[model samples]
Target: MDQQMFCFQCEQTAGCAGCTGKKGVCGKSEKTARLQDELTGALIGLARATNGGTLYTDDTWKIFIEGLFTTVTNVNFHDDTIRELMGRVHEDKEKLAPMCSGCGAPCGKTGDYDLSRLWHADEDIRSLKSLILFGIRGMAAYAYHAMVLGYTDEELNRFFCKALFAVGEDWSMEELLPIVMEVGKYNLACMELLDQANTETFGAPVPTEVPLTVEKGPFIVISGHDLLDLKLLLEQTEGKGINVYTHGEMLPAHGYPELKKYPHLKGNFGTAWQNQKKEFAGIPAPVLFTTNCLMPPAGSYADRVFTTEVVSYPEIVHIGSDKDFTPVIEKALALGGYTEDQPFAGINGGRTVTTGFGHDAVLGLADRIVEAVKAGDIRHFFLVGGCDGARPGRNYYTEFVKQTPEDAVVLTLACGKYRFNDLDLGTIGGLPRLMDIGQCNDAFSAIKIATALADAFGCGVNELPLSMVLSWYEQKAVCILLTLLYLGITDIRLGPTLPAFISPNVLSYLVEHYHIAPVSTPEEDLKALLHEGE
Candidate 1:
């Protein structure tokens, strides 16, 4: 098939539809896109092989995760690596159901389903399945991280197979829509598992003030959300004359006791993932990615980009299972960073950013928050957070955070906060008006803090004076959205624009039932979200 790829799996898809040229808006090339599709098809076969009565081994679960997680928007971009994963999926399926391969009378029951069939399916059915597929890709990232630390859920793994098998089936909108929601339901459990794993392995996060200044001398920038990898790199580089800095989602590593112990773990670098193309240009340090949200590198700094775990780019050096970051350390040493300290600031020009306010930190002040509400000192709460993209309209978050009531608290996480996290929002009721939660998966922490507040106030979550203004860009945001909807949370404001994959009927269903609305201007949305119940 001589075809340009068609992938609309992210918010940055071309023309709000699919990427239909040599490269996607995210910089994924045509060859890489096709490999991702082939990988998805093989995963479908592996899922089908686990049907009705097949024995699902531990290896099967790991391969299942690698297969689904690799196709995420920016996780992997190497054709060889993707095809290698596809081969593993098929090998696993053949091992489980031997008759399905190379038999004189082979069965069609466990054959790979062509992913093109999905792209060509009816619009409504395709939308529903896309939710299931993209949502799982995001969930798999969280699951993979948890698994690295010895956390796994049987139900979660089983649901992975069920969802993938549903993707391959000739299911109608009625059948697939619920499975789509089920992806959200299971993703909540998945996130909870990862949270437990992270907090247990690294200790609970605490409030820590991290500077934005890059110190003189050699340093390495570690991006992505694998705390274990960060910990290893920090330990490996300690006393080795190379400083380390967290970038993007890895910024929260500073809060963990195990990670914060390292003195060389110096402040953060760059803003959100979308800014990497410019931020990493001609940088004299090496950047390592440990999870999702990887934009392809430019020729100027491509040599300095190193991918570990499942993240890959065509010719980039990949630190494989060994996790020996000698290559990255050597690169950093060779770059010989800035001769003098280089001062950096967020988009707001704030010289420093703060994080580590996980659930324990926030809920510790639950009584005070309740009292402030009763005393009318803190009037409302806004969870203005999600992924950030290069799209033109994402400035709504910046303006919304800027225009929030002085007495309200703005809780944020993920890269979306890079837009406004640097702004000085001051304090309300002895707590900073703006609080930075951990990674996107740390939305579990936000949910926990919200439930605690509602419990303290003797009210349901919706009845509390809280509003969510989220900006979504990828599959992780999708699963998080689904989890919110499944919990019966109502009246969410999602923008810069709604998902293109969501059909009109499906979106209307969400609107009528959940009261979901596209965000308007900050002034308009703020007034409605703040004063509507009153």
Candidate 2:
């Protein structure tokens, strides 16, 4: 078969291999795929120009972040916009090295790389490099969100370039493997930076009940994982009589104190990003995507879709860096939403889902939680969360959560929580059975909670009665997975499928080192986890 391109960075890749046709599984066209490759190559060139230096300005970091995030699954579908961004990438590279041709220091160093070499290279090297590349792409999103809130880590900024440059080098598995793991270490730092940025800005999420009903009047559903945009929108739409709703990963924004203080910041609108087309069809409101996991919109409500930041689609209203959000507001007012309350239930037919169980809320009750664990009220803890996609195997998560013993608690984050967030497992002691940690970036909270519990028990994290059953789809999940591995957390069960990028040697290394395994049937996995902990 003559393939125009290859992309396997997502869970829904065609035939469990790369996307090798006119369009990718996520609907990314071949031209966009090539453009994304070019953008990545240019970024590598920019990183190469830095020569592992750490003195670059915020503008360079901003460009680097947007370019990397633009290639994440479903984030950018418009080939023209990607091509334009490629020009920006080239411009930045030029700024780093203006006279490569006529420089007295003729080092032949800084030039655009062709990424096809990495794809066509040896499988083991390709696997490690792919992990590093995808891992940094995920970390860049978290760093970008924090940077917007005036929090920038110099180490993170430099590591991004260092890792990008590493991908372009002729490194062996021994050399690249450490860089791959360091991507995890730095990703942990990036997630922490973002956690501080969000909690300080939004005032730490409190347990808040988010209704699933769309109230009367016009509303705009804020999707993706940007709390700053939500805050600004809530400010602008305060007295306009239009309401705001959260969807996908944005659902957790309702739990933040500062954001929830707005009476007009209404409930959530839809389930996970994979269900956007079905849930959003003919809805009488506008939707704004602020980051990744944006499926190409259907013609029915495509007119109402607005994209900001690095996320964009063809013909969609693109909100610029000014972050005005007026276009989305205007579209919402024009739509003139439902005149009465429209009750929308989750896939389980539950009418409401609760969030705001962030680290602060959970750790605040740490004493009680510790007592409950000692008292056998909470037998085990399961973290079943990560990116959600349209894969059939993803049903394992829902089933696993459903089949978890009542003595167990489920802590979920990212968009994957929507799978079983609505299911009421009742409470253990006074705490709810299911705790919704904020965004995937908020995995910091999960780590904190786990570490505190371990400290209280005088044991390591892996020795605790906690299991991490993760579902990965995109690069963000890659970083989170690496973070778990980097922390030396063992026996993590990952599904719906293992990443196609992991070579047999790498997979064997992970299994032998971390004891990682693919998820089996929910009942069997649950029983094994429960008994093994006992």
- The global Cα lDDT (0 to 1) of model 1 is 0.89
Top lDDT prediction, candidate number: 1
lDDT of 1 at 399: 95
Question: How accurate locally is residue 158 in candidate 2, as Cα lDDT from 0 to 100?
Answer: 87
Q: How accurate is candidate 2 locally (lDDT)?
A: 0.88
Put down candidate 2 lDDT per residue, 1-534, tens digits, no spaces.
Answer: 246588989888888778889899999998889889989998888887777855355478888888888888889998888888888877766777777634545353556788898999899999999999999999989998998899998888889999999999998899999999999999999999999999898888899988998899999998998888888889989899999999998988888888888999889888999999988898999998988779999999999999998898999999988889888889999999998999999988999999988889998999999999999899999998998888898888999999898899999998888889999889988789999987787899999999988998999999999999999899999999999899999999998889998999999999999999999999889878887556
**Which segments of candidate 1 are over 4 A away from where they belong?**
1-4, 52-54, 103-110, 532-534
Candidate 2 matches the true fold with a TM-score of 0.97
Give Cα-based local distance difference scores for all models. Answer: 0.89, 0.88
lDDT of 1 at 62: 94
TM-score of every candidate: 0.97, 0.97
Candidate 2 residue-pair clash tally: 0
The TM-score that candidate 1 achieves is 0.97
